[model samples]
Target: MGIDFYGVLQVPRNCTDLDIKKAYRDLALEFNPEKLQKENAKHVFALICEAYDVLSDPLRRAVFDQYGEEGLKRGVPGPDEFIKPYHYHGDAMRTYRDFFGTTSPYANLLDYLQNPAYECMTKHGKMFQQKQPPITHPLCLTLHEVFFGGIKKMKIHRLVYINDEKTKTEVKEKILTIPIKPGIRPGTELLFPEEGDQNPNQTPADVIFVTEDRPDETFSRKEDDLLMIYDVTLEEALMGTTVTVNTIDHRTIRVPITDVIYPGYEKIVENEGMPILDDYPRRGNLVINFSISFPKYLPKACKELFRKGFELAKIGGGFNQYETVNKLVLADKILRVDFNEQLPPT
Candidate 1:
């Protein structure tokens, strides 16, 4: 039997001209070698193009309908004379480019298919069309992942049509693997072109994954710097001590507190923060904020001993007298100190 032109394009034999056009356009795009990744894509696409060519023209279609393929090859007679034999002499790729007015039709294939109006514009030489906006999604990452780098898999569900019918649709899940680079800043965006939701009329939007650092109990990130609060007892704050910090990578870092830690004292550990993105060797500083916790109350004997000790430790200077008095009262209890008197200039 002769090749079924209507079956080739998947249109019924009684289908209208509009139906034939729609079917041909849809199948052509679906089977286009650049769009479809099938083994016999090129061969199948050529067959569809041939079917469309013979079925779309009024004269050729009438001849094929009456005489079939062999009749067309033998030439059909018209009222005045025999109509010349019909053959698909045009290049398939050239025809597709002319129809879409674009060499890369797959880039916006979905848009053309979904928006008939846009396709009409393209057919009339209006090649420029507004692109769909990029879709952004937050990708929450832990401090450990940002510090050491890791891979995150995100599952995205999108609506896919079962066939050309718009009524029937199915939700498809796609897993996207995102590489988290060391020191990638929060709000950094990774773009996947044309991977967003699909529509029959519009092209798929670009997918954007924005990085967001999840809150960590041990450290809070500020740009590339890591901030941590270290609590110390009154004795440790006053006397020399060592504070051990647990890092995000399960490593212990020892921070020495030799000097007395006054209120508002911040220890800066250089090159201990998050690694610089791309340049992993460089790093920011880790800032340690100290909080001193004093005992709730001190016994009368203990207060007296602390008073006597401050007097003996003549840790003096021009301001030694005031320092000694302030320490004596403040060490025993929480006392507010105000510098009311003017001091001699150095």
Candidate 2:
């Protein structure tokens, strides 16, 4: 059976990283082998270290969460770098000494362990390797690429140690491959563990790729729905029209609009929008917002024809008795032209 890291840390699965750190600190102080009198103190202390080691790092924690201990200890079947598991150093006393920076595991550990500015001194005055902050980069993905899942390759340069003794270092280029899945939203991040600059004293920083959607000219995405604009003349809007919509999947759909398009009218073509990736073959609706264009000037003859047409169709409208407003006024004062632009169209 796999060990429950959340149970060991006494935290919820969705708990924040700070919660895990605080839990480990309290537990480590209590179970330090040098301080505890129990016979199982070493075993318990080692378990705590192992759990903290996995939960502290984002990459390791994600693997442990998804595949449990078996997948984490043995490699998962993939080419992605995130699947590489980090093993515990097998020295609980050393782990404790490195973290609290104490001469002895339990000797006055609480005094300076919380101090941020103090430089830690380990056993025999040897400092432990420190993990560095992650280097983050924006990954802009086009809508086309997002619709069709593919792999993206990135070449990055970082400083690396040349010798095992940590005597020399040089810059090296590393190629990172990220697999982009269909329907991945903006702000999804891919973590490449410890791929940043290398130093003798510090562990390299993890590289993070934050996903962002590139601006598209023809379509805009709103959650799962896709929006498109179609132009229509006033005559077509009143009488109804049929439109041929060119979809992202290269399908041409002839949608018939039989009902009259009133002001602020919008039509929905079902299951024609963005793909629902998790639920394969399912899709959201395509929303068509009609933009009706009015003629600049209406001739007297044409206007008369419109009135007769409406009367014949029995469309209820007081066309002859309609009130004309030259300058709109509110509370007996004429509103400015700029203010009229701000008003919703009737």
Give the TM-scores of the predictions, in the order they appear: 0.55, 0.55
Candidate 2 residues 61-81, lDDT tens each? 888888888788986755555
Model 2 pairs in collision: none
lDDT of each: 0.77, 0.76
Cα lDDT of model 2 overall? 0.76
lDDT of 1 by residue, 1-346 (tens): 6788889988887888877867776777777888777779988888888888888888888888898988876798898998988777757876676656665746345555776535433442223244567899999999999998888899998776787755466789999989888899999999888786666545678899999999888799998889999999887776657879887767899989767777898899998898988677799889999989999998887778666756655566442344454465455543333445535458
User: What value does the lDDT take at residue 256 in candidate 2?
Assistant: 91
Best by TM-score: 2
What are the RMSDs of all candidates, in order? 16.4, 20.7
In lDDT terms, how accurate is model 1? Answer: 0.77
Tell me, by lDDT, which candidate is best: 1
